[model samples]
Target: MPTPGFPPSTLDSEGTPIWISDLAGGDPNHVLHVVRGIEAEDALEALGAKPGLIRSCELPDSKPDEWTSLPCAALGVEPGGSAALLAGRVGEWTFVYDDSGFTYDDAVTKALSADGRTAATSVYTINGDASLTYAVDGEQVEWVNFDDLELDEGFAGMPAELRAAFEAAGNVETEDFEPGEADGDILMRAACALAGLALTLDDVRRVPLLVVPFG
Candidate 1:
């Protein structure tokens, strides 16, 4: 059975599991808007981004998708296998992509290319081992062990009561905690609570996938 606080998963017509983010509602400070169809340059232009302000980086070969013919020059630290490209920053939002792999569909890409205003809300992915890899802005943060996360000083910003609850939840010493299961559910709640994030069970399952945070 699905956890109480988590959202439910849906299956696409092809029987592929589709998981939505638990953080999709209300107005969020951080969001993942997949700009489809638009080439790297076109997407930036549509966003009103100035030519001189754009930035790019060369990611390591191990990374998912590294685009060799990126429209902009390489800037910032080498993203290694974490991210292939950080196109540029537009106002409060940043544009990013992995030339190594495709994250969006053809229709979404077409819409984004045709009109700069079109974008799809994105959700991060969870790995098979229940580890979460995500990015803030364009920087990558990964290998987060949801079950055994240390709720020490890093979580000082959380409420006292919430912190205490997470501490009381104890840590999972097991190698992995399967998402959607009871153990995974507990860890997911604790992690979200510490990060001051609200997510559903279905959202938790989509971990090790793709997630965009909102402050």
Candidate 2:
């Protein structure tokens, strides 16, 4: 059996995979906090979600019109519903949760735009092993395991000065640095600075990199 907060491979009676969140032990009351922005909050409230009564099963379904209110109708409970809501929004970035399989690394794997072009350089761990994944248009483009590579290798494309700052911050080291040790927020800011893009740390953390072409 999968532990709490982990995505489950077991299919519901309808054959849909189950995804869950750790917020409030998958309780709706606590997990709803993951939803941000007054717009998103209003949508949730209009959908009949209330504090302390929201359950993992009562979230709106992921429909084709995900960004619109169509998906906000608290129609029925579905497996992974809570996770879907939690990953719904954090301002402009739309979080994408991995529901393809059951794994302890069940987390927001991609944070992209509504148009599906830009994406965050995602860092996550599985069973204590850390890795980095770069994606575009919802497709993974690169994946690197921390153990097989140095921390600096991932940021080689970054500008020299920004890279140096990261190194000075102890985020990039040839021999001693390990993956999952560096602060993701700091690294994201460094990347943004190198690109000359003005963005908040929350934006950096949500979607670290912007995909070139809108996809």
TM-score of each: 0.24, 0.32
Off by over 4 Å in 1: 1-33, 46-48, 55-74, 77-95, 98-118, 123-215
Best by TM-score: 2
What would the per-residue lDDT of candidate 2 be over residues 103-215, giving only the tens digit for each residue?
21212223221134434332333233434444444454444454564454645764454345344323322233345444322332222222232333233334321110000
Tens digit per residue, CA lDDT, model 1, 1-215: 22232222332221112211121111211212333233455554443445555444332222122322121112322222322223432332333332222233333334343433323222223331232223223333222454554444443544453344345433332345343222433333333323323333243333322111101
lDDT of 1: 0.32
Worst 10 residues of 2 by lDDT: 23-32
Q: What is the lDDT of every predicted structure here?
A: 0.32, 0.30
- Model 1 residue 122 CA deviation (Å) reads 2.3
